[model samples]
Target: MEEVRVKLPFNLAAGETEYRSGVWQGLVLKWQKEHLLLELPAEADSISSAVYGGGMGRLKRAVNQFVSRDYECSNPVRDMEAKLVEWGYPLEGCAGLMTAVPLEHAAVAEEDTGSAGIFCCVTAAAGNAARAGSQRSVLAAYRPGTINIMLAIDGWLSPSAMVNAVMTATEAKAAALADLGISDAENGLPATGTTTDAVVLAVSGSRRYAAEHVYAGTATDLGGAIGRLVYSTVTASLRSVKAAEAERK
Candidate 1:
């Protein structure tokens, strides 16, 4: 297994080859022949931004601060995003960004190969939800929650497959929250029903990767990691908020 060391939050003149997928939030996935590797800021736990307008430009700066500029990496995930934010920046909704990288790449399944891979991130916030059985009224304006997924697979997946991945991730996400019981949630219904909104992201794969694009079981490599990470990230986000509320009491 070839291991590549990466310095995060810096200018990227080109892309790396260990990864079969594209870039998400400046992080790219690299397959070490067996396991997975992602070039990310070690301090990146949860990403939050208030400057909704120039988000792209600002997101880079924010990531740079945590991964590049800042040298301190001792902060805990529970509240690292806010603590890392430079003074004077607006603190709005947290992106709840999370990435998955196996500590041991040697454990990756031998069957997981070729374009059958992914590099991804997910942000989840389920503040707003609609009832599963109830009809939604477009006229009845309501604030929607943030539930999103970003995926960069190794090959050129058909439109249907892309949608399939999204659906798969969605189901996985809902299950994640449902597992928590979200006892404090007031969003419409309970398990088997209420689901949060989401956004899926991906980039074009390499020509080598484009040769074969097949999405089988998401239990290994990209799919499995994504499902688990999304669940953890969202759960962690909810935990922080819930914990804060308890403190207020």
Candidate 2:
């Protein structure tokens, strides 16, 4: 399946709602008394553009502007986490969530033929929408690469710890992107405002596969913890298989 890059809505200021749409479904990135919803068409196949039916060019421009200007520094995780801590999150004990998805899985999706590819199965809804509000403002402070980590945290962690989890993931993801020559982690990543905290990273041209680690808040939060455990276990299993394949080579 083709992996397409998408831009989120850009006008989500304080108290303003932003809406984004795709071909199959819609999403509302709800904020403080605001909505960032995505528009979707009935026929998924009709989507020629990226998320929001917008072209990739527009997406690219938005990315460059958001990351280049807003996220000016090449390294901003430290400052971002500092802000989070100031906001009352005990980030010292925060753990890293890490996992890798192999190209073999992509092949499996292709072979299935009846299913929507692996991208669709594990992908998040997205479109162009800017982050607003104090909570969102904290999120927008980081680069796209780091923001994606936060996005994963929002999915994996409970609402109570979502903010802190995102901070931790942001640190990890920034390190990964820097190692991969992605220039600036802030602008290099791809995200959509399809949901409250849904985002997908742009991993083309550098890595052979995409990795995501969902920090599901804490052990007490069963819902988030289960998400973390399932993803971690599956990824570890895949990594072992991948390592074995490498040894055969």
lDDT of 2 by residue, 113-212 (tens): 1211111112111122222221333333323321222121111222333333333333333332233333322343432221122222111111112322
Off by over 4 Å in 1: 1-117, 134-139, 142-144, 183-188, 191-196, 208-211, 216-222
TM-score of each: 0.46, 0.21
- The superposed Cα distance between candidate 2 and the true structure at residue 247, in angstroms, equals 5.3
Task: Put down candidate 1 lDDT per residue, 1-249, tens digits, no spaces.
Answer: 322111221112343334322333345444332212334322222222221211211121121111221223343233335643533333332222221221111111111245544444433344443344554544232122244344444445555555556656666667766786642244345532234343433434445453533452375344554555455555554554455457889
RMSD of 2: 18.9
- lDDT at 169, model 1: 64
- Model 1 error, position 15 (Å): 26
Provide the overall lDDT of each model, using Cα atoms, as 2-decimal numbers.
0.38, 0.25
Model 1 steric clash pairs? 35-105
